[model samples]
Target: MKIFNTPSNSSTFTGFILLGFPCPREGQILLFVLFTVVYLLTLTGNGSIICAVHWDQRLHIPMYILLANFSFLEIWYVTSTVPNMLANFLSDTKVISFSGCFLQFYFFFSLGSTECFSLAVMAFDRYLAICRPLHYPTIMTRRLCTNLVINCWVLGFSWFLIPVVIISQMSFCGPRIIDHFLCDPAPLLTLTCKKAPVIELIFSVLCPLPVFMLFLFIVGSYALVLRAVLTVPSAAGRRKAFSTCGSHLTVVSLFYGSVIVMYGSPPSKNEAGKQKIVTLFYSVVTPLLNPVIYSLRNKDMKKSLKKLWGT
Candidate 1:
């Protein structure tokens, strides 16, 4: 398949201007403050989770370790757009250079994709814990968890290499303006002079299919886990089972629901508002909520935090 349409004549794009939210000056300032607060919270929450997991030996289980990795990725994920977005909100113009744009997409997609696969791994972990309780330790061993984490990073990095290389070949001419706060794939592609049909097709195929499959796997795994929990004779046993899996499900619902909506559909100009809202849920809000979701609901995490802080 043709990676990118050949330019009628090769010309380097000077730069791309990002046409962000059409808000009044007051609205822009408000957005900056809102996002600034969110970014700070995201950093602190994820950073705290990472440090707690690292320093507390009692919290060194596979689940917390996975959470630590997710925390680190969340830091990078929010950083990719929030800083540039803050700058855009403060300035009159929001123009990003071609190299800068590509780099933004690289980090955004890389971290996002890793999180996608990481969620699946977490679901599988819960499945082993609840559905096959006796084999949880043997099956979800330390080596296996390490390998899964490594796979998430490697797969996320490799997934975008082809797409970025292909985008590099395409030429961007005049009207170098992008819609939205960041150099996202959909908004940026609309500005390209080259026929982006192949790029679109690649996105069309790569975007939704894996998410749908993973969604199905998560549903099936949880279904079995629920069945196992129901079989527990004692109320305490059932309560314990539910507590273990409840936070994971809550986070999965929040992150996956917003993410699937944003990337799972074809690009459209009209969906800009919807896109921004969903992006907020997945990118900014979810990270801030994750530690809270896990810590408040999980007894182990609460105990560990109490011990870690000597409270």
Candidate 2:
């Protein structure tokens, strides 16, 4: 690989060549088809949840409202990368414009951040509903729910603005090839002309703080919920409480497990392939599974979905 100088101005650089899963032509085609099916399923699954929430009056409470918003977020979240990935699979030259790359980077991370906050908010809602049931209605009002939703979006987008801007402003060196399907920060940072320890330190600190703190809060919330559920005495009541939380817990595990593996620590130079596989699991697989998990496990969601479909 020949090393060349990247223009000082980011705009002037030709573009990035994403070396995404180099394989035989047949393999590429197979991947394209497989990913296409996954994308369509993800859209349908999440879309159904959104529509179900919208049409069903019974699901108008804060839990369902947050779920609807989460499904909406999943749609955009998967969209931020999968389409471009599909396109890359077909094309011989896997070129992504500088602006386009950064745009993908921005939205991918922003939506991911939003998801983290949304999960925390959802956990908090569950906490109030389960642990403090008497005051749940008064505390988690429509206004408060809407405000929490707004805050998730606002904080998610704002969280990475400075870091992404700073990274983008930095100069890129030769090679101009990203090793992954999407515009990930690790690969992007690897392409930089010079490494800035200060920026790396800042990103390392910022990237994991929200996730770790929110995860701890969720654990605490669930612990209290568990204590409350234990006090209910009746087996049926305990089962119902666990059923309500089961879906959220599953989704949270899938999300946090993959994310912690990928971003909790710095990306290892030799683990690019492992990182890509883990990223694919969360980015592509989890979204498709969420609706299925929620609908199948929760009677309320199943009924709502059935009513929405008129089945």
Candidate 3:
């Protein structure tokens, strides 16, 4: 099927071909099945966390509330790309319309940005809870907690807004094929007929530098947390503090490690396959593991999950 109406005509925008995994039909079927199972598991895992948090009255505190919100964000974050990729796996012509492609591009990045902000906030929560235990309650009041969550969503979505809009408006002449499953900044930038170095620079800064900064912020917060934990007189007290933070630290490591590598430097077109693998690890695998980490690491969350299952 023809992706663009004319191969050379830049103005004619029909759609773009999503060059998803170049596998045999049989491979496509297997991939579809595998990803379908993954999708279900991710949904089930994140959904279970949300339910467990809401169901257990004991988890009505600030930490759990933030967790429930993060779990909810995970649901949408995975939804932004995986479902379309699943559809592409079964499709003969994996053509996504311009609107659809950009929309996916927008949401996928927005959700990812939200995840970064959410992680930072979670790290801050841990810092306050551990480093300044006495003032945690006053600092993280219900109203302030709600406001922080709101700001994460707002700032995250807003982060890439101008860059995306400006890129979308640029001309794409021909070869309307994106190498990866999702519409990403690198491929989109390459496909644009008009060279916009300023946009590229902005995109470059927005993608990785902010993440690197957030990573530093989280690290600093944890450093303070570690100091406070060490100051705890009792071994049990130290264990309790570390245990409270261990799950979040693990998650932060998993997420930022891959993300920094993926967007650490500008992606070369040659690294298409590598990009897909990294994207899958962060976007698909992370959400699936979050419930396990939180529930198993957290005694209260585990009890809640057990009770939720029993009921």
Candidate 4:
């Protein structure tokens, strides 16, 4: 549990040393090369999706608009952590300023929260499109879609503000070394000088509410979509319906599955390595896979991508 070698008073601690995965020099170089490739691919993939959505008039529907926005969010979300992680890999000190740490903390969690809301919104869009096709065009207007996107961003950034501020103000008594790649709450909380049960309680309660609520809403929406799909008289109709949803469902499963394993459960000493792996999967791998999953399965997206490439 004690990862810090020098335990100092909170007043004397100026910044934190993020003790990212301890690896030999060769291993660090290997990892650096690997992650750099991953980061570039993440950008290229999500960026392509955004471009396809923007340029393709046929893709200017509610679903594609939401997807473009989600792709944009993914760009910043992975950027908030991966670049810094890459830097830490090269640097010997691996130190992050207090302000830098919290900024990463705020943006990373906020973007993640925004993604949760975005997925829920996408699911609701699907529900309307499938279960209530007649009302979908009338109900999911451009103005309404814009409002939903705005609300997702606003609510996501606001969700963790109070807790982050409170945590920032708390005293840190010892070695200010964070164990994970990012300034996650659990590791950061462990560094506090005095345990604030109230803050811990608040975090434990508030941390999962948005994720759980949004996840439940998505489940419900998809349930309705499934029912509707089953009622379709033609097999082709059923296949088309499932095709439209399959990518989102895959993404949802990958996202929520890793997240629930990471945040929904209590932290344990044995799970630290597992935690890092899961976090990397959701944060880095999932973004990388999203464009592939969407484009490969959706003919419209593939055509748009091809048009964007002038292929």
Candidate 5:
């Protein structure tokens, strides 16, 4: 595949031009500044969580440990695309190597899958803590938490391997310009040299299934948790349970709701603007909010944050 030059003259393509959000030079500069601020905040917020969890001795429990790991994942998840997007805003060509695009596609989606699994595991932890309080310690040991974290990362990354490899192997027609910010599967498919019904079918199946299933698992876990919380005789216990669960539920709603709206049907070619907004919400905004949700909602986390900042 030819690596450079005019798409009109070349018969082969080895790179793609990402026409990210058509705008004037001034508009791109404005966007660059805005995204730069948001990206920095995301890193600070999530990085603070990991630091708080580590520096604070009280947070050595299974819940904080998992939260720390999830924060770590969020860091990479946003990094997989935001930096590149920010760079594209400043660059003239906005060119991405074929290998670079697929790598972004893989890491971005994998981290997202890992996040879904992490959320589900966190729900399970809460369920065990609430519904089976007597067995909670024995069941959700630190060892088990570590294993669950490992499994989430492993499974999340491995989920997209076959489809990405299969799709990357397919030939691409000329005029390799993707009409979005990142290398999303749908846009990539549109650039393929021929109709790929089988590949599309595989995407249709594999794309939303895990997200749907994991979301259902989270909801089911929360259902039992709610039942158990209601049965608690103490109102204080109930309030605490609701407060903790509420934060997780909010993050879940923000992340999954946008994801479901965006990739619910493999993203049609017409919704590019709306898709960018939703993707921006889940990918950039959600990570920034997660640390705020946890730290403010949980008393111990607030105390830890205060201590971390010496305020």
Candidate 6:
């Protein structure tokens, strides 16, 4: 892939343009309203879950702590994507400065990485709960949970730092148009004047490897969990066993499903629209799904929420 550039080396760009929300003028207004409603709900729903989890002493176990982390992550995760997207939808020109673009990419990738790692941690938490029931309390201590959350942020940032640094070095003197709503790595790579095959390859590897590892961990954890659940002997015990993990599995499926669709294959024009749909899936829809799945699916969460709301 030859990085095309018609200008001399002195040519530089002030900012990269984002041709985000490619709908008509009337459509932009509708999208702004729609996204605003969704954003507010995301904040409220995820925020309520966090508050409920914190206030209820009975819900302060490792599972709810992980659920709180998921809720907190969902708040930032949707915030990272929707605010910029909403602004672009409402703005006349969807232009972001180079520094601004880099900053956006950093937060977007950081939050995304945190979500991935948090899901993996949640899976491990479930695995220990189901497979090693007697030792679960001793194994997942409060200090351990704090360390895991800290490690998630660290891992998420570290994973994206290399690609962001590489992108920073590349010059974008040509066309400034970006196809997507935000300053994502793959689409922004299309604008660079330098041949970034190496960068592309690096990103290809970076993108899928962690996801694959997480997929394996989730699968392995759930498999063991299912096997353990089946051995419970009593029919009611099996239903009770599934209730504990059903919500987590639903969230895991929604997030990883969107991710696999968006990044698993090579990028194309046809795929771009679908990718955007899946992008909304992971960003907007999944965050919305988190509280719904957790609250409706988990009896404990529902009771905690009821008490918190004085219902």
Scored by lDDT, the top model is 2
* TM-score of each candidate structure, all chains considered together: 0.90, 0.94, 0.94, 0.95, 0.94, 0.94
Residues forming the 10-long window of minimal summed lDDT in candidate 5: 2-11
What are the root-mean-square deviations of the candidates from the true structure over C-alphas?
3.1, 3.4, 3.0, 3.6, 2.6, 3.3
- Report backbone clashes per prediction: 0, 0, 0, 0, 0, 0
Error of 3 at 251 (Å): 0.4
lDDT of 5 by residue, 112-223 (tens): 9999999999999989988988999999998899899999999999999887888787777768888888999988898877878887988977988999999999999998
Q: Model 5 lDDT vs. the true structure?
A: 0.88
| Deviation in Å, model 2, residue 191 alpha carbon | 1.2
User: lDDT, candidate 3, residue 249?
Assistant: 96
Give the per-residue lDDT digits (tens) of candidate 6, residues 19-70: 7769898999999999899899889889889999899898888889988988
User: Across residues 69-181, which tens digit of lDDT does each residue of candidate 1 receive?
Assistant: 88888899899888988888888867776677788878887788788888888889988988887988999889999999999899887887777776766766656777677
User: Mind giving the per-residue lDDT tens digits that candidate 2 earns over 200-303?
Assistant: 88787788788888889888989999999999989999999999999999999999999888776665766879778998999989999999999999998999
> 3 or 6, which is superior by TM-score?
3
Which stretches in model 6 have alpha-carbon errors above 4 Å? 1-12, 265-269
Model 2 misplaced regions, further than 4 Å: 1-12, 264-269
Model 6, CA-based lDDT: 0.84
> What number of backbone clashes does candidate 2 have, counting pairs of residues 3 or more apart or in separate chains?
0
Of the candidates numbered 1 and 4, which has the greater TM-score value?
4
lDDT of each: 0.81, 0.90, 0.89, 0.89, 0.88, 0.84
Cα deviation of 215 in candidate 3 (Å)? 0.9
